[model samples]
Target: MVHAETVAGRRTGSPWLPFAVRRLLGLVAIFVALLVVSFLIVQLIPGDPAAGLAGADADLADIARVRHQLGLDQPLGQRFSDYVGGVLSGDLGTSFMYRQPVLTIIDNRLPFTATIALSAITIVLLVAIPLGMLIGVLTQGGRRRWLDTGFGFVTGLLDSVPGYVMATFLVVMFALGIGLLPLFPPAYTPRFGSASFVLPVAAIVIGPICTVSRVVRRETAVVLGNDYLRTARGWRLPAWKRYVKWALPNLLTSTLTVSGLVLTGLIGGAVVIESVFALPGLGSGIIKAILDRDYPVIQAMVIVIGMIAALINLLVDILLGLIDERTLGGSHVST
Candidate 1:
């Protein structure tokens, strides 16, 4: 998967040092941008935040006091500076609605979101990699051509379905379109090993499994056609060595790249899934915070989610570098 042009750009200094420094610098830059954007975006929302939160009971002076309390009376630059200073000192401020520290609320809700995301991703990797390789091997050279067409059709259809739509459909079909659930329990809890998890997890995994599997399947087909693989066959190598040693490594590279993207999408996509299932995950929590104009909660969740997304992409690059340093390019790499 390493591009040819990158080879000429490689540094002669040290092997991984230059690459690691460059990546860490880029990560820090991304984090700064994430903080600025997350903190500022809520200020752009329409209406007076102080007045809205103060509600009908408060008079004009009460609203002004509320604005002062929130630093809304200050200049935009001054407010932003204070916000950054507070965050750097590890204070996310208090939630307007919850009347508690923002970090405390997030810590309380983190496990629910973590459970769904982790469960869904683990299932996707387990199912997609094997299914993809099997289909690739079976349909090679146009043998069993019908499997290719069917596989493409099915994966495309499954992947196109949104998480909310899938969640709703699953509930209706499997839950008998009623309040009662037959095959699975009604809701999710952190009480591990709950049968209630089955439906929500199934909803989350459908699209990701289809996406990662298709990438693997296509990569496998390409690797199978490689000259080195053909040469291995000519030498009468064992099937395990020919396929496992030669074919699977390339599959891992592509699979890891696509898996990272799918994970980022999962963080965003969990909102609708959480809504449908009435789960108290970060996704659903953000929706509530937005509606209530809870700035601390909103900003903190955005920072947390952005950090997760950035970290995932960074880890993927590191893995790609491990496979071959050339994949990470050099100092003057293209965007």
Candidate 2:
């Protein structure tokens, strides 16, 4: 016999449907807001895009002609309407500096940024998860207060350092001081085989590792305190089976949610890290565009970053719903 709660849950559609729809709507709203804010901010920046395109030595008449040609002579409302329409139609327009389509420039540069971001995330998960699990297990039972305190202190210290500062430190220690690696090479590209990728990935990984580990440790500690965990311990089950098969699954639902946020932050961090490492990625491209006041490139980059972040959050939400039935608005069933 189906319960009333079950019927209500069914009537609401797939348990995750409402949540997914809400999140999707929110994501669209955020993207729209970003577009408006980016457009307005670019307009407020000094120097005319038309003038910039016309060249410094070009006289007023030449600038005016360039503006008219670029449709900048239109009323602000019409120009913004066109800009928003272009965004909706997936036409980010052309780059004033490169004379190439903005999407083309982004496509060319995306792989490098993606490689760095993925590498950093890989390193973070590989190192942080195991280390955090170990710390959580060892520091359980509240008997070893010092161990927990020490771990917290270390992670806190690491998190306190900014990405740029950490990048500089890594460069000084590994690249310049020890003379161990090349700082810069002519026409460099980031590939998996290159030794040059290390410092930037390392710098990007540091804070995330610290932050993720702390979250995992806290969650693990909480899972350890659960009544079922106590019962499992009383039953004399092997430590590995108890923690790995049982405790870890519960910890992951929470840990992964935090990891999604961390991953999004890594995208922003990539900009600074790429610049510091002098990598030819979107981050460096963004810096150059900002200096040149290249509106199309800047707006496109912001939107791309927002989309990536929103997708990550969506995936994380779905995963959480799958892992914990209660999160899908269903009753939790204990096996």
Candidate 3:
């Protein structure tokens, strides 16, 4: 009979089960860290949540009552304990500024943020992958020096530009300068169906497209150098088959890894874009909350955003493992 340790040591069987369990634990660790960091960071910031909630005219008794009501008057350890308990029990606390439950506010605006973030990432994958692979195929073996030079310069410039700045520039050019489009569409909430949705999504994707495509191109160039690819070339296989069949499968691991990381970052970018476009989403809400020193709203926002990011990375990690089972246990895959 095989020992359980020996069976485990072989590193064979369903890949995702163990991977999912491990990453789920990692998600817990990340959640705990986010809670601690968010709480501590807010504490470090100047000003008082109670004072903001009570208003300038509020007397000492009013501030004291508000503080006690919000549990701010409790000891630090007790406050943290209560905060953690509230989170585990699906209580995100109430927003002092909005005078509503934090989850309710997030629930209302979350769809907008989700739409923008998901749409931007989807575009990045669709555009960047094909564009990068095509460029990589074209520029292999140091061919097309001028095209390569131009590509590098262009993508680098675009990648360096932030999403908010990109949004502003596009607005200035299309709406304000050329008079082709309507001015910033922040008047109504922008959704997937609205024409107003175009600019913000465009802004978030532009830089990420540049970054991902460059990575893909570099990976493609490297993949072209492998022995199997050389053998394919030896057979004088057509360009399309050699790359589409031989190269794409290999490219999945790296592309997904990079795109997943970019996806998380796109959440934060969407926040900036939402504000620039004047959308009523988490971005605008969080900015207002910060200005008001609304700790509950800030913590809730951080938690929601952090969960989205963690989930994205977890999905990516699982995909990478599925694509290449060797990645199931990073730095510890038994041969």
User: How does model 1 fare in lDDT?
Assistant: 0.84
Off by over 4 Å in 2: 1-12, 329-335
How many clashing residue pairs appear in each of the predictions shown?
A: 0, 0, 0
Model 1 alpha-carbon drift over 4 Å, by segment: 1-13, 176-188, 191-193, 330-335
- Clashes in model 1: which pairs? none
Candidate 2, run of 10 with poorest lDDT: 326-335
User: Looking at model 3, which ten-residue stretch has the lowest summed lDDT?
Assistant: 182-191
Tell me the lDDT of candidate 3: 0.85
Residue-wise lDDT of candidate 3 within 1-335, one digit each (tens)?
Answer: 45756756775456667777788899999999999987776787688888877888999999999999888899999989989899989999988777889999998888888888878878999999999999998999999989889999999999999777899999999877987666444356545756667777888999999999999999999999999999999999998998989898798898898889888899889789888887778887788778888898888888888888999998888788877887886434344
| Per-residue accuracy of model 2 over 156-195 as CA lDDT, tens digit each | 9999999999999999999999988776575766577578
Query: Could you tell me how far off, in angstroms, the CA of residue 245 lies in candidate 2 after the best superposition?
Result: 1.1
Residue 118, candidate 3: how far off, in angstroms?
0.4
